[model samples]
Target: MNAFDSVVVEVADIEAAACFYSAVLGSDSPHVCLRASQDPTSGFRGFALSLVVSQPGNADAVIDAAVDAGGRVVKSASKSLWGYGGVVQAPDGTVVKVATSAKKDTVPVSRDVGELVLLLGVEDVKASKEFYAGRGLSVGKSYGSKYVEFAADPGHIKLALYKRRALAKDVGVSEEGTGSHRLVLSGAAGPFRDPDGFVWEASASAPLTATA
Candidate 1:
């Protein structure tokens, strides 16, 4: 089965980004890599990292921690078709969605975000789907021409693709920008960039875990 590994973010200040993400994630993560970018500008990153928790209430606490860690609330916690979640902008400009489903898990609750998923917005959903399919990512549930989700292992970050403008509106951002998307995916055949400029790096390093 195809699976998502991890994401790399380019930030102006690696230390600041690390501090903020560590707080939201509960433990300092080896998952989030902070690279120094010669041109760091905050904008709608065109991608969102989702934190799926076992309990709905956990999402609220995460939002609070994210704000305290220098993240800005893009949207407050609320029930959505997908589940209960809200959007926040990490100090480095990465959009994060904290959500929970009705389903329950026995996993011990922690002060950190759980089950990270990488959501990317692409210009053409079908083309993007074809691109990844060629690269070995298997498709799960999908809405023709609108959205496509990939199957992933338990606790691994799941990958999904949605229409650029619609995704931007979902998390409240303008679907416009340039340069690197600042996302890297490990365990792929090799490093590749999506049509919209999202970078995925294939690394042999140990996969990123939801909690430390």
Candidate 2:
């Protein structure tokens, strides 16, 4: 099964980013891969990292931790059609989402141990879906043209795509973006750039330690 084994977000200060993520996501946060861009114009705006909690209250706690660790709130927590979620901006402007599935008879959340997903905003959902399919990734479920979620290997982060503007609205950001994504994903079927300019690389590395 195809999966996002891990995601790397480029930050101006690697150690600071590591500390923020570690404090919010516990000790097993995504591995840090430092990419100090010479171009100061680069800032992330398109994608988001999701922290899936087992309970709704846990979502609130995670968001609080993020704020205490130098993050800023982009969108306040609330119940949505999909679940309860909120958006926060990390110190370097990378958006993070904290969500928990709401128990519902019609749309129940699956019981899975994996608690993370790297959500990318794409210019065209159909085109991006085909691109990933060509690389052996398959869509497990979809919500018309606005969003599509892919099946992932157990214990690996899940992958999902949504319309760029819709994603921006959901995360409470403008559709406009510039420069590098400041984000990367490992263990995609192959390396490719989505229509929205997010890059995925085929590589793996050890998780960032507190001393890193």
Candidate 3:
């Protein structure tokens, strides 16, 4: 299986993004990395990052931190049938969401994130699933044409796919986006671009192994 190490979100200003993420996600957080890019991108970047925590209070805590650190709330934290979650657009145009299946807090709320999900809003979920399958990522879960999730190694970022329009609606944004996706996934997969125009570069810390 292709183990994705992290995602590098291209931002216009590294300094500002650094501060924003530091305040929002703190330093040395797993899976999300940042790089400086002045790529002319606008509207939805066709992707979003989800921080899955332990409780509803944890979701609120992260959402508050994100807003305080210059992020704008797209959808305020709320309870849904699936879970309690909210959406916020990061300072660099990346969609950040905090969610948990647990409705109530079992323990004190902290900034601890249980999992980070990378959701790509693609044109075709099945095609995207096949595209990633070709890159050695196996399917973890699938909901027909509606959604798909790929398995990840322990300590790796979880990847999922949803329809572009639906994802935008879920995050409370317009699906019509142009220019760069402004997102890159670096892992043992080396360099390749997916069918939906997501870039994949090799991770320096975890380079792709040559097949025998």
Candidate 4:
């Protein structure tokens, strides 16, 4: 079965974004370096986000499949502004990005960023939970029967289903007008909500020790 691999966030500043993710996910700062485009031996260079996937070679192919499956390519695969490999946007309007290295041994190792969690605002939490459960996800935790969290991988809550109104209230928003706000979480593993009504969370594979 096709399982989750990684979630990408498109930020205006790559450095800032990396910093924010590192702090929020409780992971070490991302490795910073310049990519050598002129060197044939040196493949494309740019910012890189290390994520876990069963098939590393299929990273590009999986993205292609996502596009074919109805996901839009918001940002085509290319050298990102942050100096890493990346792809943005999937069929559901969710953005997914990736980075790679030319030197097999030098490829950045991804820490166990806990579990990549996604908060999906649905009309009905129960139905959403049921739908995902039928699709191979296991129900993990629930809160007051209002919100439900699902696990796609061990140590990671893949998705969190919540009611739109309830979410707004949790953030102290009235929800009278267009629910628009960005919630940023800082730590090894935490969750945040974007202005587009999508919730995103990331966690490092392991606890952080130091920062650079």
The C-alpha TM-scores of every prediction are 0.86, 0.85, 0.94, 0.38
- Alpha-carbon deviation at 106 in model 2, angstroms: 20
Give the RMSD in angstroms, all C-alphas superposed, for model 1: 3.7
Q: Show pairs that collide, candidate 3.
A: none
lDDT of 4 by residue, 1-212 (tens): 22333444333334444433443233442321111111121211111122323233334544455455544544454433433333544221223444343213233444223234455455677766665566555777877448887655544325566676664443233334332222222322235443334433443322322222
Instruction: List per-prediction Cα lDDT, in the order shown.
Output: 0.75, 0.73, 0.84, 0.40
Q: What is the Cα-based lDDT of residue 115 in candidate 4?
A: 30
Best by TM-score: 3
Cand. 3 TM to true fold? 0.94
Tens digits of per-residue lDDT for model 1, 1-212: 57565666767777777788778874446556556675644467688888877776677778888999999999988876766778999887888888888444345555566677788888899999999889988898789999999888765668899998888998888877676666566755458877877777776444223221
Q: Model 2: per-residue lDDT, tens digit, 1-212?
A: 57667776777776667767876766654544445443343444678877777655667777888898899998998887777878898887788888878633243333222378778888888888888878888789888788999998776778899887888887888878787777767774647776676678886755653322
Ranking by lDDT: 3, 1, 2, 4
lDDT of 3 by residue, 70-121 (tens): 8999998999999899999888999998899997898988988888889999
